[model samples]
Target: MTTGNSGSPISRYTKDRKVGEGTYAVVYLGKQVNNDRKIAIKEIKTGLFKDGLDMSAIREVKYLQELHHINVIELIDVFTAHNTNNLNLVLEFLPGDLEVLIKNTSVVFKPSDIKSWLLMTLRGIHHCHRNFILHRDLKPNNLLLSPTGELKIADFGLARAMGNPNEDLTSNVVTRWYRAPELLFGAKHYVEAVDMWSIGIIFAELMLRTPYLPGKDDLDQVDVTFRALGTPTEQNWPNVSNLPLYNALKVYPPPSRQELRNRFSAATDTALNLLCSLTELNPGKRCTSTQALLHEYFTESPAPTLPSELPKNDVAGGDSDDDEPENKRRKV
Candidate 1:
């Protein structure tokens, strides 16, 4: 085990307060003594650190090191404690993430606020696609809000670089709920459209202040999605029925447009229409992330707010104490 200057295995820069804990790692709020700057440190367990480190962690470090954008979380450094067997990843510590923000506040966002979030989210995802990187995970939790109210996409654990368009990459990725229909249908060969599906889900969630389609599992998720948007037929999603996992689930007739209009009562007509276009059940029919970026929702009057101008920490207000265990640091 290795420690920092403080001589403890994990070192004590600032006493850690638990922020978020996931299956393989726990994120901590810490500071570097030399500069006294706050940072988010993700510590992977020694036992779980496999032959090298996890591929997802390695991919995140490799891609973020070369990809820099205001809308994307910045990775500062990577180091190991003096005596510990685990690896430490240091990242810019943003005050809060969108998940906590949406949950804590009851404020109905102005259309402008919604557009700002949508635009920033697309800009960040667009940058990733331009670089040939796909952010497979893009739910509210992975989208962090800076103290300045700007949103930065974080948690690139499931991200991957695209290869030949015809090649089949990994199938077991993306969280179940935000997963695109192609992924749920076992289309190993996919493209950036997968990310666009998540963006559509996110857009609906932002408007509704809840998950757009909350399914209990993969099958249920598909059922919920098709139920809302209507099942894809040969005319709707041409190649969808040919997908690997495509099977005859009891087919229900498509729902009327009136049903959809009533379902998204809070969303604007333009926004609802765009959501329908982007969330097409067939990968071939789904809109690209870049196309969605150019949609009228972003071009309307009272345009989206520039990220730098957004209010910082408007979503959540909290602080961390230095006396807690390093592993327990909570994200602000």
Candidate 2:
């Protein structure tokens, strides 16, 4: 909240090096001047747009300022640079992300390891949803990993607080691959179930060690999604035809239980149950974050591996200590 020409809040942190550059901002790896704590500074280019600043940058600042959780990225500081008047957000420095680990074939992912990541993701989103915030974009790349192995959900650019019943929300949110059936069908009014669907896809990705439903484009997304999960119809989805873009879609029979079992061969029955519930075609039927947290999948044998004990991106062997007594396992 401080402003100055030479002495300002921006002077409080040192930008060591530029790590990434996007259309609206440049990310720098730096440290807090006082404590020497590492941080990532996102320098927003204020002059790029005629309107002054990008909405994504505004949303990131607005939402992250209100959210505080171990599994959520912390917005450490916000300030405008002295002369250029450019905005900079100091965020916690996360060295790794889930996408890296998932794409790295050498890093083997155990059932428990997958459970830990999914659990952390759920916890983070649960907090957001409970606060009436929708993290429209929930994917592996947005889920960052701390040095201590904690998974923190990042990227609030596409996020917005849940709107009222009469308010029309945008259906064109969330990444194409992780998008929910409702969003795919162009539903203008959606609930937190959208986030649930993304988490479900992420869960599947973690288990398979690859993207589960890799759709080529928007049209192909619908085809690939339905071809794999089956087409949504009134019978199973209940009034799904009422949606804006529900017409003219190929119908594929829902996968048999055995088919699902075969698809996720290594998953436990409980794990599959949670997955199906989360990915339920109907937003009404999709599992809520609260319900998912309490699902039997978390309580069943082979409890979630401790975050610190989870596999590392650099560790090709992906060894785990699942053999440790369950009683010693503390909830994340």
lDDT of 2 by residue, 1-332 (tens): 22233566776788876677778888877777777677888988887899989999999999999999999999998998668788888899777788877888888888889989999999999999989999999999899887689999999999999877899999999989999989999999899999999999999998888899999999999999999899988888898999999889998988899999998999999999999999899899888999999999999989889998988764322223122121110111
- Specify the highest-TM-score model's number: 2
Q: Look at candidate 1 and tell me the lDDT of residue 272.
A: 76
lDDT of 1 by residue, 1-332 (tens): 22355554345455356677776677877776656677788876667654767776787788888779989999877777767767777888777666655665655566687789988889899999999999898888788877677789987878888987777787667777788878877888889899999988888887777888899988898898787777777787788778888898657676676777787786777887788877877787788877888888777777777666654434333344433232222332
TM-score (all chains, Cα) for each model: 0.86, 0.92
Q: Please give the RMSD to the true structure for each candidate, in Å.
A: 4.1, 7.1
Computed on alpha carbons, the lDDT of every model, listed in order, comes to 0.76, 0.86
Per-model tally of clashing residue pairs: 20, 0
